[model samples]
Every structure is written in structure tokens, then in C-alpha cells.
Target: MLNLGTVLAFGALVLFGGWAVAAGVATRSLSAVNAVFLSYVASLTLVGGYVLSVRRPISGTGTDVAFALLSGAFLAIGSISFYAALERGSVAIVSAIAALYFVVPVVVGVLYFEADLSTANVAGIGLAIVAVVLIAS
Candidate 1:
């Protein structure tokens, strides 16, 4: 049976599939900083509303807070760089190169989290890397 987490993950995938296109199109009409700031505003409002509605506890340990802050920092850096690239470069190549961001999580999962992956998972990652290289080049 498909769980809520699985379903939400798939939904996120669908939503994100159009993100590069949206960014590319928007950057054509808007400055990169303006586009990114507008996105941040929307994301903050939506996510903040959802959290408030859920009434979920947001408190965490110091380590957890530090990690969250660090994650946000990295996200800000990446998003700014990506939107800037989109403003000046081909969306396809920029998005292709940005897709390599997943490698960080995969490596962290395997090393720190000790996540196990099947042979197929490994092959898929390898193929994704090759595809990005081919696409970007």
C-alpha cells in the first residue's frame, strides 16, 4: 500500500518537474533576484500556513536547529545561484547541472545515515550522473 509519505514524495516530484521551466520563463521577464525573492515569499507563506494549521511542534534540540539553519543556508545559496544561471544561460544545461545536487544527499545517506541501496539504485544513480554530464555538455 502506498503511504502518505510516498504519495507526497511523488506529488513533490510532479510539482518540481515544472519548476525549472517556470524559473526559466520567469527569469525571461523578471530579474533573477526578484524572481527568487518572490518565490521565497510564496514558499514562506504557504509552508508557514501549513505548519500553523497542523499545530505541530516546531521545537527541536540544538543540533536539530543547527542542521535546519545549515540546510536553509545551503538552499539559499543554491537557489540564488540557480536563478542567476537561468537568467543568463540555457535552462536545460543549468537545470541539468543543478540536478547533481542530489549526489550530496545520496552520499550523506550512505555514509552518515547508513542507508542501504539495492544494485538497481546504484545503477540508477550512475546513469543519472552520466545523463547530466551528457546533457550539460
Candidate 2:
């Protein structure tokens, strides 16, 4: 049986998949920067409203706040680059290539966090490499 986290994650995947398709379609009419800007504005409003409704304290350590800002910077950069790529390239190819971003965190987890890579994880990484090569060619 799927746990709550797994169910929520699946829901997120479904929503994100729909968002990706909508983004690709919308980018045809809007510039990448504009699209990202508008999309994030909406994101902020919704998320901010949720926080307000929850009445949760927005407390975090200095380091946590700094890390969150840094993460947002990275996400903004990546989103702009991705949207730009989608503008100039085939959406299918661009998305497939972009989807390999999971490898970065996987590598960090293994190398820096001392996370173990089981046989299936290794096989998935190998298959991801092969998929990239096949897609790029």
C-alpha cells in the first residue's frame, strides 16, 4: 500500500506533468523570461496564501534562510534556461534531456552525503546515461 508521502508525491508528479505541458504550449506566445516571471508570481501568491491560512510561524535559522534563497536562485536559473531551450528546440527532446537532472542530486548524495547506491540505483544511472546518449544522437 502506498503511504501518504508516496500518494502526495504521485499527485505532485501528475500536477507537474500537466504544468510542463502547459508551459511548453504557453511559451509559444510568451518569452521564456516572461513566462517564468508570471508563473512564479502565481506560485508565490498561492503558496503565500497557503502559509497565511495555516498560520504557521515563518521561522528559520539564518543558514536555512540563506540556503533557501540560494536554492531559489538555482531553480530560477534552471527554469529560465529550460524554457529558453524549449523555445528553440523540440519540447520532447528538451524535456527528455532536462529530466536527467535527477543525476546531479544522486551523485551529490552518493559522493558528499555517503549515501549508498544499490544495484538498482546503479543500473538506473547507467540506463540514464544510455538514454541521454541515444536522445542526443
Candidate 3:
């Protein structure tokens, strides 16, 4: 029987694969900014409704709304840039380069959150960087 970690890993892989396929379809159908905006709005509607229904109201300073809007704006820009890269480069190359975002959270966790990285995780990070370099080259 598969372990919990293995099951979670498999699920993540499936989710990412599905996301890539859907993104490709979306890119083909509309401008990446449009695709991103529509998707974000839809997701916000669903997730926001669920949260409001299930969770107690938090104190919403204007800062909270500003932050959420800023995040959505950044996501839209990133998606547009990615779609543009895909147009100019091979999908495989663009995807491999884009995968470097995985490092962003790790770096933020270490630098800002003071999370400890195991030796194995450090090695994994090194390997990921090397893979990105090789794939981009």
C-alpha cells in the first residue's frame, strides 16, 4: 500500500499536470491576461463564498483588500509573461524554467520565516537549480 506522502505526491503531480493542460487550453483560447483574470475571479468567487460560509468574519482593514488585489494583479502579470514565453520558446523549456518558482517559497521560508532546511532539502534545491539551468540551456 502507498504511504501518505506517496499519495500526496501523486496527487500534487496530477494537480499540476491538470493545471498545465488547462493553462494550455486557456492560452490557446484567449489572451493570457484575460485567462488569468477570469480564472482568478471564478476561483475567488468559489473560495470566498466557502470561506465566508464556514469561517467567522475577520477584521478586514482596507489593507487586506489591497493585498488581495495586489496578489491577483501580480498573478495576472505573471501568467501573461508565461504565455508570452511559451509563444517564443518551447513549452518544455518554458515550463522547466517556470518550475523555478518552487524555490521562491523555500527561500521565503528560510529567509523570512526562519524555517530550517535539512541537508537533504538543500541538496534537492541544488538539484532543482541545476535542472533548471540544464533545461534552459
For candidate 3, the 10 contiguous residues with the lowest summed lDDT are 83-92
* Number of the top TM-score candidate: 2
Candidate 2 residue pairs in clash (backbone atoms < 3 Å):
none
Per-residue alpha-carbon lDDT of model 2 for 1-137, expressed as tens digits?
99999999999888877777877987999999999999899889999999999999868999999999999999999989988987888777787788888999999999999999999999989998899878877
lDDT of 3 by residue, 1-137 (tens): 99999999999888876765676677775776777677678878998999989987766789997988898787778877877675566677788888788798899899999999999999999999898899889
* Reference-based TM-score of each model: 0.86, 0.92, 0.67
Report the C-alpha lDDT of model 1 over 6-39, residue by residue, as the tens digit. Answer: 9999998778768888989989989988999998
- Residue pairs whose backbone atoms clash in candidate 1: none
Give the C-alpha miss distance for residue 14 in model 3, angstroms.
2.3
Better structure of 1 and 2 per lDDT:
1
Reference-based lDDT, each prediction: 0.91, 0.88, 0.80
Leading candidate by lDDT: 1
Name the regions of candidate 3 deviating beyond 4 angstroms. Answer: 1-12, 52-56, 59-73
Which portions of model 2 miss their true places by more than 4 Å? 135-137
